[model samples]
Target: MLIAQISDIHIREDGQRCCGWVDTAPFLAKAVDKLNALRPSPSAVVVTGDLVDSGSPAEYARLHALLAPLAMPYYLVVGNHDRREPLRAAFPDHAHLRSGPFVQYTIDELPVRLVVLDTNIPGQHAGELCGERLDWLERRLAEQPNRPTAIFMHHPPFKTGNIPLDRLDLSGKERLAAIVSKFRNIHGVFCGHLHRAIQARFAGTIAMTCPSTAHQVHLSLGESSIMAFDMEPPACQLHWWDGHSLVTHTAFIERFDGPFSVQTGERIEIRTDSIHGRAP
Candidate 1:
C-alpha cells in the first residue's frame, strides 16, 4: 500500500502571490499532475496543512479548485496558517473534521492505522498539544495497542535545528514523547510546517516532514539565519507498506531526461535509448 503526503500548498486568492513573490499555484498544479501520473497511484493523499496562505474563504475556494483534479482520496489537517472554521466550512463532507472542535481523527481502512492530530493554536505560529488533545491521543493509541499506526500532525513535536523554525516548534513535547514511547505499535509520525523535508528519531519512532509543493524554506543552520524561501526542486513523499516494512521515498515534481538503465561489463557506458525498443 502506498500513501502520499502533500504539504504547504499555500494557495492564495486573486492575483496575490504567496509571500508577495512566488506564484505557488503552478507549483501545486505540477505536484497534482505528477501524483496522477504515477504508475500505481498512492492509496490515499494526506495533505498536512497550511492549505491556504491566510485561511480565507476565497483562498479555500481556490484551493478547492486546485485539488479537484487529484485522482486519489485526500485528507486534510489544520496548521498555524489555517483557520478551522473556514476549512470546515469549505469541506463539510469531511465528517471527522466536523465531529469536534479539533481536526483529529483516525482512518482504519488503510494498511496502517492513521491517527491525525490538531496542533494549531488559535493565534500563534508555535504549536501546543494541550491536556485535552493528549488525552484524546492516549485513548486512540490505547484502542489499537498492537496495530502499526502512524500519527499525522501539522507541527513536528521535535526541534528541526533551523533556529527560527525551532522557535515555532511544538510545545509540551516531553508529554507527547512519554505517550508515544508507551506504544510499541506506533510506527511513525508524519508532519509538515517548516516547508522542508526533515526526519529525526523521536520517542523510539521515526518522525518525518514532507517538503512543500510550493517554494522551500532556505536551509541555514546558523543562529542568525532567518526564515526565508528558495526556488528549489519541489516534491512529494510516497510511503509504501508491504505488511512487513514501511518505506518512504521522495518523488520530485520536475520531469528530467530519460530513466535509462545501464549494465556493467569490461567497460560500462551510459545508454540513453531503450535497447529492447530499438530494432536490432
Candidate 2:
C-alpha cells in the first residue's frame, strides 16, 4: 500500500541546468539512492510527469540511467515537457507507455488501482484531454466502479492560484470532473505541473501535486512568476492507506547540526551581562 510520488525531474541531455542554477540530475540520483535505502520500501514509485526538459531522446536516455538504481517498480505519465516517442522508446517494456497517439493506461493491483491519463497538448505549454484519451478514461472508470482508485496525470485538474501556472492547467476539466463524480471509489488525483506541493478537492476526491525532486517554485503569492531555484533540497511524498484513511508525508534529506531536544521553562541569557561582568 506504500506509494512514492516523484515529479518534475526536468532532465536535460545537453547538461544544461534548469534556470542556469540547479543541477537536476545529481539531485534526482540522490533521491533514488535515498529511496533505495528506506527500511520499509514503497510498493511502487510513480513519476507524475515532466520526465525530461525538452522531449529529447538523449534526455530520456539520461533519465533511464539516473532512475535505473531504484529498487522498486516504477511507472510514468506524459507531461508538457515529455515527447511521447522518446518516452516510449525509453520505457517500451512498461505497459502504459504508448507511442503513436497517447500514453495512458490503468495499473490495477492489490489494495489500489492507478488510472494513468495523458493530458499533454503537443506544441503548447498548456494541457488538454480530448478525443480518445477522455473516452478511454471514462471506459476505465466505468469498468472499475467500486475499486479503490487513484488517477494520475501530468497537468493538475485544479488551479494552483498562480495566474501563469493556472494558464497551463488541464482543459476540459469540467468533463473530466463529471466522469469522476460517477465513480465512488476514486481515492484521489495526483499530478505535476506547478513544481510545488498543492492540494485541492474535485468530484468528491482529493487532488494533489508533488514537488519536484530538483527545484521548487518560489512561494510568491501575488503576481505571475517562473522557475525560481533556491538552495532548498529536493523532496518527495510518501502515501499509504491505513485501512481506514489515506495519509501522506513529505520527506527531505539533509544533514543537520545536531539532534537537540527542547523542553518547557528553558532559560535565556543576555550577552551584555557577560560584558558587564568582565573586568574592563
Q: Write the per-residue lDDT of candidate 2 for residues 65-97, one digit (tens) a residue.
A: 899999998988889988888888887677568
- Count of steric clashes across candidates, in order: 0, 0
- Residues 54-118 of candidate 1 have per-residue lDDT tens digits of 98999998888888999988899899999999998888777888767788999998878999999
Off by over 4 Å in 1: 264-280
Clashes of 1: 0
RMSD of each: 5.3, 10.3
Instruction: Give the C-alpha miss distance for residue 51 in model 2, angstroms.
Output: 0.4
